[model samples]
Target: MFVARSIAADHKDLIHDVSYDFHGRRMATCSSDQSIKVWDKGDNGEWNCTASWKTHSGSVWRVTWAHPEFGQVLASCSFDRTAIVWEEIVGESNDKQRGQSHWIKRTTLVDSRTSVTDVKFAPKHMGLMLTTCSADGVVRIYEAPDVMNLSQWSLQHEISSKLSCSCISWNPSSSRAHAPMIAVGSDDSNVTYGGKVQIYEYNEVTRKYAKAETLMTVTDAVHDIAFAPNLGRSFHVLAIATKDVRIFKLVPLRKDSSSSAPTKFEVQVLAQFDSHNSQVWRVSWNITSTILASSGDDGCVRLWKANYMDNWKCTGILKGDGSPVYGSSGQPGALSGVLGSAAAQSALNGATGR
Candidate 1:
């Protein structure tokens, strides 16, 4: 279930992406208007725009936030073939009140010859690392040699893909036992070459990234992909948005003592849903990874959950400004077809983390 909340009509073009901060108290939205806006949640549970500025010359594709420990840092990628890192600095005020925070450009990554589609910061334990995917069919990882300095970055590794890359997600867990993992999705509509979704793992022995698995079942162009937050589960869960919403369970292979082979992983489809009826553009998982929110071209956002028996079903749906339109899988006490306001509020509260 979802309630209607509107941002001011400041953007001149379509908004491309929205991302929440690590604590869910703030959100950043980017648009084709070449601008970005930051919103903060108030004590009354309403979101208010705090800052809005133009950050790029071309259309901004995506915006991502670093961990709060990094002191209010953000990264944005644009169609200008460059990615910029911005840091927030508190301004000096003559009055006895605190002044507004000013954002300054720290670094510009200009390695991509084409448009940069996505940018993601590595986990906090990785020490100021970032990964960017481009329309040039390349994925580059950059690291800051010193965490205190934000302007200097060293390109660590570059991997070439067969098709244009659209989005990427990094595994958030910092377990040293398992190699760092990332998932990349391709937006190429051509089906002849079979470029859809690929997973890469950091090979510590070779000091580079290697392709670990390719999802063959997803033949269509993938719009977004996300790896769920691991909660001591034996297998990892991944969600992909294409023409439909597909969930997969990834299992890591055990180390072989006899042959000394490298570690590998296998993926199996856990569930698929076509309720959107159109191209699904975005998919996001809650903090617990129990519920998933999906937005599509159908102008609706739907929430899905799995029962105790592992059967996935639609829990709630939200259309335009009206109340949440419950489906047949709604709770037992809910109305046969429609859910009451109290029930919808309770359901939506559980879906969103604070």
Candidate 2:
């Protein structure tokens, strides 16, 4: 059954994003109040606030954690037209006395002229890299030349989409047969612009990223995009949040080994859903990429799963802190507990003062 668990996020304004660490034991939340808070899960399964501080002068849009291999590091982008990297430091005597953690700003990226909407850390297999997309229709990739020196980052590549970008996801495939790739989504309102999703692949010969494919069927403004965790699969799965939730399957087409051209994909739309009745704000997949979760303006999180025949269906519908609105008879429903839910009941309560 679906259940309600009060997180008491304690942000002064609406929370925009919530991100769990690689281990799923730690989390960070960013809010419109221009602050970010880190939470640590206790042995009793309760999340305790370990650090809270102002992260930007403007509303923070997204916050993400780096691979645990890089230590405790976080990256955040905001409406302030900049992105900042933060590192957690413990045992400062005063902090140690209180048994608290402290996060310091390691670097700030100010390349975008418009608000930075999304920030993400690349897959661990890609080394220590960061990507940021802004409303100015630009995507920038940065790398820390030295893992030990967190204060310095070099802007490696910049790609212009010619459409306002709202979100991005890096293909997590670690197989040698696949190349490093990224998908960028746009929130541009002009319907005249054909498609909103673009896929780019790293060209080893050219030593740069090249446009491989454009999802022409996705004509709507995309709010969030995520690539399913690759588990030795030859094809890739992508979930996009827009007016509706959509799933796309990208099968890599075979190419000549001597070809320097980017690999092409046989793109197919697996599923499209409008059960939310409004814009879907976020989409996330389980670690295994079997179950998908989407939240929207209708105030419900719907879980999707595929059957043995690869037919995708909604297995459950859960409201914010309430009894079961609906559920599948045998489907594993509770959603990894409450740690991954970003749109907590606080938003519903805050709007009506209930």
Candidate 3:
């Protein structure tokens, strides 16, 4: 029942997003401070910072690791109005002339003019496609790293009618089970008081995109959305963050004998809960899909569990480990002492086999 002490409180500004690689051996975090930090889990079960790099001129909003085969690749976006791909290069040959140990850079792909709020690599086809949402109210799809040049990539298409997409999530089995479906939600606006949520389908036959004909709109601005990660055993479900967190089962469109074409599938709201006082900012589910974690502007992290009825009920809240507070809120300070204390504590615990 204890919260793991793995992440460090290193960001000066608020952390917007965090992601773990497929193997769960490495993790990355992006913050409003305009930087991305990488952490590696050691054999002793401690999370240690392996590298930190400035990836944007403005606040970096989100970061996601590529999955499937290209495990080490990362995609990040920022308020500076750009999205970049970062991959950890192994050898000294790939490093800059400065002889840096690890090298990272901007991938030449779908760069945006307005702030890029979120970017995610499709889980099934890691190197094939990446999807991004921005303040410009667009959801654009771009090809992943090009095999030939590696540096050059192109934007294949864009969806331009969204109203400031707050977040997006792609179905993991979209390539095989489903057909590359993405659910996106917008910020609350006066026109749509309930907010807007749209599910898009990628047509392999025509190589075009279309909105799911029937059951894909919501009444509230989506704060954050996530497709269930563990796909095979269970039905495809999407968890969304808003005034109240909602979980929906996405039933794929089935063609009836009378109707030649597939109909818009129906969505069943599984559970609803109002857990945060302020706007909920992020939602993450583990591979089990039984446990859910959410964070918001209230500066608290809460954990929830799914019941037999598919209802999400709060399980517990994670409290800080009472590590020493370092600096005054008004003054800038170094994070060395705080980091050292945490690392030493972890090392000591590991040594004692606690």
Best by lDDT: 2
lDDT tens digits by residue: candidate 3, 281-310: 566776666666665545445556777875
**Candidate 3: where are CA atoms >4 Å away?**
6-9, 93-101, 174-177, 213-217, 233-235, 256-263, 320-354
Give each model a TM-score: 0.88, 0.92, 0.80
Model 1 Cα lDDT, one tens digit per residue, 68-141: 88889999999999999998777643432342346778999999999999999998888889999998889999
lDDT score, residue 304, model 3?
62
The global C-alpha lDDT for each of the candidates, from Candidate 1 onward, is: 0.78, 0.84, 0.64
* Candidate 1 CA-lDDT value: 0.78
By TM-score, the better pick of 1 and 3 is: 1
Q: What tens digits encode model 2's per-residue C-alpha lDDT throughout 1-354?
A: 334546888999888888888877888888889999999889987889998999999999888999999999999999999999999987754735385788899999999999999999988988899999999989999999999999999999999988999999999999999999999999888877778999999988888888999998888889889999889999999999889999999999999866889999999998999998988888888777888888788877787889899999987676765544744465444544532333232222221100
- Backbone clash numbers for all candidates listed: 0, 0, 2
Model 3, CA-based lDDT: 0.64
Model 2, runs deviating above 4 Å? 1-3, 93-97, 327-354
How would the candidate models be sorted by TM-score, starting from the highest? 2, 1, 3
Residue 165 of candidate 1: its Cα lDDT? 94
- Superpose all Cα atoms of candidate 3 onto the true structure and report the RMSD in Å to 1 decimal: 8.8
